[model samples]
Target: MNKKRLSEVIPLWKADKRNYVKKSTFSTYVLLVENHLLPYFGENYDVQEMDVQNFVLEKLENGLSQKTVKDILIVLKMILKFGAKNKWITYESFDIQYPTSRKSHQIEVLSRTHQKKVMSYIQEHFTFRNLGVYICLCSGMRIGEICALTWEDIDTDNGIINIRKTIQRIYVIEDGERKTELLIDTPKTKNSIREIPMSRDLLRMLKPFKKIVNPAFYVLTNDSKPTEPRTYRSYYKNLMRFLEIPDIKFHGLRHSFATRCIESKCDYKTVSVLLGHSNISTTLNLYVHPNLEQKKKAIDQMFKALK
Candidate 1:
């Protein structure tokens, strides 16, 4: 039996894995290995379960979230399996445990009054850049999706916006110097490629400009050049500050849209589809949070049913 060090086998495994996954995914795996896994396990070909458990604990203690640690572990497992398949190493699966009680964090969303105030402000004092935020509030589009949208993606006749691509600046290491590149690609998931119908108000606001704007120009920039997510996020932050609105992450616009739909008694399946969530459970877990009134209503219904 031949044994190879993890450091020696990982490069070969990465070369083989590169052809199978998306460039972004491949980059993520490379990053995880280089940043987390290889540094710890590079010398060991036959990694022990206890070693991995300790790694997880140490990472958590260092302030890495459970999801981030899990992602690192996924890349680690993949490399281990690759080495095993080629007889460079042997494999053993390990079960990991985490704290049963997790800190519950509520999703932040704008209040209805604040939402209305922002919408009204945008309607009265509108710009092509501000329109992206308006659309996110109404349609639940992500920052990347809004940044990538072209005028052609909006069909006024159909009143739907086709979500096809997303723009992100990705990290890369070139010649041992780190640089970033702008990548315009399909969205993060297949489900993210979807069409959302525009609200009547949104459609009305967009109609006059659509006639004069170039079809290929990005919506946010209203020019051939595109605005990236980081820039747009800063723009939103400044806008909120200028308006004296409470600060929230750019993603909260998406959360606000989904929460409004759920609050209005929109069905779970439709809300899930509109938000481009991969599955209904994600929609339920995030947006189906029952308020006090809802819990009280449920109890009242149960008592009435007994009568």
Candidate 2:
């Protein structure tokens, strides 16, 4: 792409500070240059105002979402600023704004009866993966954190479990079906790296499970390697189907946990901590929170006392 007409300074400048960036950031920068920037303006291309306008229009029409277009434009602006500073090109003000973002979607929470029925189904039928489902129901652990759980993190004597990491997998569409790739990652947020106290029942259930051999991780295969996220998801889905449960995203269990917490008068701060939320605001804003029934009950109690 060093073939276009305007200036050769960009590649040189990019190569110069390659050492300053961290590996992941540098990799992303390389990808941006190779995959996005270069194709539009090979080396030696002059970017006139009209050319910039035309490119912006093309970007919008190309099915890039507004957020993505905004990001691309930000990258462009940085490159142009770099070019101007190094004396490669003259500058004009470029306005970069985005179309409004999509509104937040509503969260779905299972009603108490459905939650009880699902638990009963799992308990009576599927014994092995029940811990996986139960933790999501009780603590709202992300599937990744649930999958990453290890025997070492379980403090059976103290009735607490340390959440240290998570397993994440991304699926890229290769042919028609998606191909999966796995990566072990830090908990989604720093707050997610936390400790959850086990209920007495949970502690009792896990006692015999602790005798299982684990060379390193808590949840492992026969060979002691980690459980793959996709595999866990498949197992979870199949278990739900076998139980004859209505199909809800596995994440709904987390919502049910949080909702039940509120209904039980578990304080928001405690619920926030239990859920490993980075901030209480995230817990309040995202969780399908208290509804009118809870509020009406409190008002009714106050009036009954007045009589």
Candidate 3:
């Protein structure tokens, strides 16, 4: 087989890859490769399963989440597959195992009281920027999606928020120099391009703006220029601090919305669709947890049915 270092093959793979994926997705792949994979295995001419297993363990030790580690591995495999296709290296399949932890991972969400307090605060003192947060809480839209939204996408007459696009700043590496660019693209998956019915309050809040605001301008900025996720996240953090609410990551807003839906006994499939999840299982895994009371009630109902 032809022997070549992985570093040598990466450029060729990336050149071929750039044509096939979205710019933001390609940037993500490049970042994962540069930050995680290249440093570990760039100079090596061959990669073995054991090497990958060791790398996984090291990444885990470095506090990378299991999902992030797996994402890095996926990029690794793609580059290797491309190299193999070009006859530059022999690619072998890796079956890596992760250490199972006894600790249960809990999803972060704002408590119901805090959620209501934040929503109430936004409604009482409404700015266009703050309205974005209110929209996310009511419709379960992601930060990127909400940032990319425009007045045109909000149909107050129908009370529907069209979730068609997302915006983020992506890091791009070219000629060994790294730069970031704001990218506005369609949602990552087809499922994410959806329609969410607005709550009555959300519809009322947006109706006045819909008549006066520029249809092409971004919702958050109320201008032709869109605010990037990083900037919006910073604003969210400061807002939480000012309101004396315990800070959670920005994604906690979406989680909080989904958790509220589940708590309301909304159907799992409906919640999944509203959240734009690819499948219902993802929604269930993240939000469906039966408390002791619910478990006891379920058991009682089963015995009653038998009797």
Candidate 4:
């Protein structure tokens, strides 16, 4: 069977995305095609709306997670977009409504006390193995950004860590055990590349571990092999266990670092820069939301000021 022409054209489109889009984004596009798409679409030489709609409806009826369905839909739309570009499929706004209901889960940041406790636990139980976790807790570096850190990127003398590249998970593959490809690439956006001022505490903590020369490309690695995010996370879980703390996602550290900075009266812009946020507005919206806690504080502070 001569594979559909779209199969041939898809690679070209992905190559375009890689060159024009961020590495993380390109990785996402590629995964959608490889895992969810190619498996099903490989048989469909010519894609049709009725076929796509039936597939989507079936996925919904089968009770797929909203997130999974959303991902599938996104890839489908992108593929249709590719087809339209090549005149294989006529372009039009989607006709049928997509299954919608599940709102994105809210990320609850650590309260001041909880954040402090977590930090204190990390500090007290700190080991060389978890030095990277400790640094991220204090510095608000994203997991990808920190994992991409190179020995040359850290400047102890200047008390700074240069933010250049990030390590992002692109896809899960089967090579016996489920595996994910980690691509070390540039930050999410131009603003994601910024110099973050390192705290003296972190600088001093890292001083001993700092290698004078690292032949391996990455600063964070084991046995000269680049460490995968999953293994790095296993160590974090062990650290939390040792400290008798509740297990939280690695991203919570980002929230904790941001909250601590706010509590310490670090300017929002500085915190934003420290986090390497592409936009200050995004930092405020996500990390600096004016929730019930802040609302109460605002009213209380206003009354106090009047008094």
Candidate 5:
């Protein structure tokens, strides 16, 4: 082996990685390396399985989500593998263990009444920003996607909202100086680039504006400059507070939309496609819990069939 510390090998690995991934993806990898990996293992040449397991435990104890810690491990493994391939360090595979938690994560969503109330309020007093929230409720578009949407992407004639791009602020480290930049990029996954038909009401609301709005302007701002997700999130939070609605994360809008669709007995595959999920299983997992009534009805139906 060339006997180089991990810090020495990281730059080489990053330079090679930059060519293969999207800018947003590369930024995410850089963050994982700088914030989680470097301080713990920067000077080390060889990281053992025990070291990684302990790191997983430490990160969990420090309140990182299991998913987040797993993401960090993936980045670490990739960097290590790259270093080993370059003969800069010896690579050993790591098998890390996580303590299984008994608690199930509950997805937050607005109650049907609250959803209607919010929608009604937005309809009664419409602004471009409020319109974004209404559109998310109707179409299940993510905040980033909605923020990046331009008037040109909305097909008023066809009553479809074309989802093509997403915007977020990403942290970047260049020449050892850390800074943030607003990045407008393609949706995270290819499946996320899709077309969602607008609700008839939504189409009617949008038609008049579409005729007058600048095609290049962002839908949320109705201007050339786009608002990034963070700022949009703050506006959403304040709107909820002002309306005396319980605060759920902004993503709850998307979840609320999906929940409504499932409740309406929309097919799982169609819901998944409309929500831009990579697969139907994701939609089912998120929104398909059976209530006690549903469970009892299913059992009754099964008994009747047997009889």
Candidate 6:
């Protein structure tokens, strides 16, 4: 039997896998292999469970999130399985355990006053570009989805915004060359392709211009050329600073929208569908956190029922 290095088998596996997955997915696998797997295990054809377990610990120590490390391991396992199937190496199944995480990520949201302030300010002083931020606040559109939207996707008559595509800049490495390119593709999942009703305020703001702007022009730029996510994010940062609002990620707008919906007692399934999450559990887990008031109310209701 011919001995095969892990490095030698990776390219072959990538070539096979490339045809079967989305470009974004393939790019992620390649990135994980080059940055994580190759550096750690490329020279070793005799990969073992202990080596992988140690790699997981090392990655955790290096400050990579558990999810990210698991993603890397998934790619590594795929390559190993491919090599094993072809008789290039032996494959061993392994389980990776993470220490109990003490700190949970807090979902950042705008205070109701802050949210109202932003909406009022934008309405009083509006720009075509500034409207994107308002849309995100009113509807839970993601940065990429909002950036990709063209005027044609907006239906003034029905007051709906069709979320059909998303724009992102993806890292590509080919023939030993690295480059980043803009990719306009369908949203992250089939669930993400959805329609959101425009608020009355949004419709009023957008209606007049909708008659004048070319349908093919992007909503963000009102031109054929669309602003990318990075540029839009910078614009959002400026808006936040100008409004004297505390610093939060652009994604926080989406979180604020979803949190507001859950607070208003919108059904979880409807919130999930509106947010384009693939499942209701994700919406519940992220935004349905109960306050002390709600917990106490629940306890009171239980006592009343018992009586």
Candidate 5: lDDT over CA atoms?
0.94
lDDT of 4 by residue, 15-100 (tens): 56667776566666676677667767655557777767777777778877756767877767776687677666444555555766
TM-score of each: 0.97, 0.67, 0.96, 0.74, 0.97, 0.97
lDDT tens readout by residue for model 1, 210-300: 8999999999999999999999999999999999999999999999999999989999999999999999999999988888998999999
Model 6: per-residue Cα lDDT over 1-307, one tens digit each: 6769999999899989999988888888898888999999999977888898899999999999999998998898899999999989888898777888999779889999999999999999888788999999999999999999999999999999999999999889999898998999999999999999999999999999899999999999999999999999999999999999999899999999998888888989999999999998888889988889999999999999999
RMSD of each: 1.2, 6.5, 1.3, 5.0, 1.1, 1.2
- Tell me the lDDT of model 1 at 184: 93
Write down the worst ten-residue block by lDDT for model 5.
89-98
Local lDDT at 248 for model 4: 82
Q: How far off is residue 185 in model 5, in Å?
A: 0.7
Query: Which regions of candidate 2 fall more than 4 Å away from where they truly are?
Result: 1-104, 170-181, 215-217, 220-223, 288-290, 293-307
Cα deviation at 57, candidate 5, in Å, is 0.4
Candidate 2 vs candidate 6, lDDT winner: 6
lDDT (10s digit) by residue, model 5, range 1-307: 5689999999999999999999999999999999999999999988888889899999999999999999999999999998888888888897777899899879999999999999999999999999999999999999999999999999999999999999999999988899999999999799999999999999999999999999999999999999999999999999999999999999999999999999999989999999989988889899999999999999999999999
**lDDT per residue, candidate 3, 231-282, as tens digits?**
8999999999999999899999999999999988899999999999999999
Question: How many clashing residue pairs appear in each of the predictions shown?
Answer: 0, 11, 0, 0, 0, 0
lDDT of each: 0.92, 0.70, 0.93, 0.72, 0.94, 0.93
| Model 6 clashing residue pairs (backbone) | none
Worst 10 residues of 3 by lDDT: 200-209
